[model samples]
Target: MRVAVFSFPGWGHLRPLLPLVRELLDRGHEVSVVVAERFAAAAADTGARVLTYPSRFPAPVPEVRTAEDLAQVVVAYYEEAFAALPAAWAAFADDPPDLVVEDALSTAASGLVADRAGCPVVRAFPGFAGNDEVPLNGSEPEPGSPDLDAEHPAIAAFVRGLPDRLARLGVGEDAVARVRARPPRANLVFVPAAFQPRVECFDGSFAFVGPQPPADPPPTGWSPPADGSPVVLVSLGTSSNDNPGFFLACGEAFAGTGWRVVMTTAGHLDGATAAAMPPEVELHAWLDHHAVLPHAAVVVCQAGAGSLMDAFGHGVPVVVVPQQPDARVMARHVAALGLGRCLEGPVSGADVRDAVLAVAADAGVAAAVAALRSAIGSAGGAARAADVVERVAAATPTDGGSQSAWR
Candidate 1:
């Protein structure tokens, strides 16, 4: 089988899909990955054919606070999708992909590719999958906060205009309708069903495969401190992680605490500032989580779905300080699951220290972590994701023809 995979530029968006790509390749299938120029090397390292497109926006995506901001974000996401279409088409021009694996948010790009190839698609969700029973992040917005379901006129206008734009590109009505349909042909959620909210609502169409670890772990040249103190890994992921205060607070929190702190500042801190950090804290611009998680005893992070998965996969607990609404929901889930602690609103160095210490010492949290790790093991990682992809591909006709699964 020939498979084509698509994901956004960020590490969080691209990382989860690579392991699945590697699995497909190992099974004697051809795989091609379409990603932004910044991510091309990582995608290529998986041994899949890499197709590059220019990124549409600057790094550290601006926070979305207003309806207009949300609309702008939608526009930028599609812009990147459209930019990616040509490279994707060219890479599979002679013989189109039999299956297309998509990052859940890359709907527009996936729809266009599937429309052209007339193939089945599997949407990969890095986090929770929502239904009528819950929102996408798997939790309800706080009272008076903007509900994800609420329709803002700006966002509505963009959505309303999509059909016509798709039409101009020769995407037929049937194809558009199928792409807009709910409960897609197959949804490969990269989270265990045990961790999903209201798990009863999702049917067989959803395969809750937990996060896929790196097929080939990257080298980071990092190791635990020789003093043998427990290690804490702190990161806020690639985007929306420009909170200097949070990073500084973390530095202060672990200072002189007999804990080895490894942090990924993502260049949010200047050289002088980073150099001034406590002797026990080591800061980097970026480091693969796989290289750090095995040695980590605890993680202090921003509650990103990918980050949480990395911690849980290793049975490491977390102290989540959410910086966005979606993250807030995941934070609650962490606390509810007894897997970690959630720190809400503004926090001080002392608050972070207290939470990290408290979560680390909690016997109940350790048990919950063990249970979730077992669940992740059973949910299947890359191998299971490959099975779902092959199953969805098999559902297509043998004559290399299309079906309603991806009209």
Candidate 2:
């Protein structure tokens, strides 16, 4: 089978899909990854043919201080991505593949391609799967917030113009509905079923495939400090690393403490700023959390789905300082599952330190983390994802009736 995997530009979105793509290739199937130009090299390393597309607008890096700001950021992202879809579609049209696997968030482009090419589309959720029963993030939006109002001017305009946009691409009116619906014919979620919101409500259409582990462990020269202090790993993921103040707060929180802090600044912190960090805190521009996480007693992070799953995979409890809506949702799920604590709204250094210490000291938290790890192991990460992809590929219609494929 020839599998075409489409992902948004960010690491959080693309990384989860790599393991499954590589697995398909190892099984002797042809795989090609369509991604933003910035990530083509990483995708190519999976041994899949790489197709790159230009992202016209810079990926948004918002300081999500309020719900409204987050809403605007989401809207702006969709606007920018939707603008680039026509060109992205044209690139895929030249060599359509047997099946389409796409990041769940890349609906604008993927929906059209599936419709035009009449191929089965499998949506991969790098984070939580959205449904009517559960909020997209873990919680409901603020009342009257643009995030909840589909009729908000920006989203409304996008929806209103969507038909004409599809028409221009030679897609039928039925494709408009697929573009709006959240689930695809089949969906793959990277988290274990225990972590999913409203898991009981989901039907057979969703597969809880657990965390996709790295195909090959990242090489790292650093290890736990040999001084016998417990390690705390701090990261804000790739796009949200602009928060220097948060990183500094983490440094201060652990300063003079027995815990050793290892922070990945993702190169967002300047040399002088990083040099000024507390002596007890070690800073790296980037480190494979997979290599470093097993040594950590606790992870203080932005609670992105990938980071949360990675931390849990290693049985390291987390202290979440969420920076966005999805992160907030994942943090809530973490707290609810007894996996860790969620710190919301203007968290200080003391808050960060206390949450880590509290969760670390809780024996029940440790037990819950262990249980989740076992569940994740049984959830069948990459192999299960490949199985679902193969099944969907076999079921796709060759005729132009794929607009109703999800049904």
What is the C-alpha local distance difference test score of each model?
0.79, 0.79
Error of 2 at 324 (Å): 1.8
What TM-score does candidate 1 reach?
Answer: 0.88
| lDDT accuracy of residue 391 in candidate 2 | 73
Candidate 1: tens digits of C-alpha lDDT, residues 269-318: 98767877898888888887788888788998888888998899888999
TM-score of each: 0.88, 0.88
Tens digit per residue, CA lDDT, model 2, 357-402? 9999999999999999888888989999888887777763453334
Name model 1 segments beyond 4 Å from true: 57-61, 78-81, 90-93, 146-169, 213-219, 396-407
Report lDDT (Cα) of residue 21, candidate 2: 92
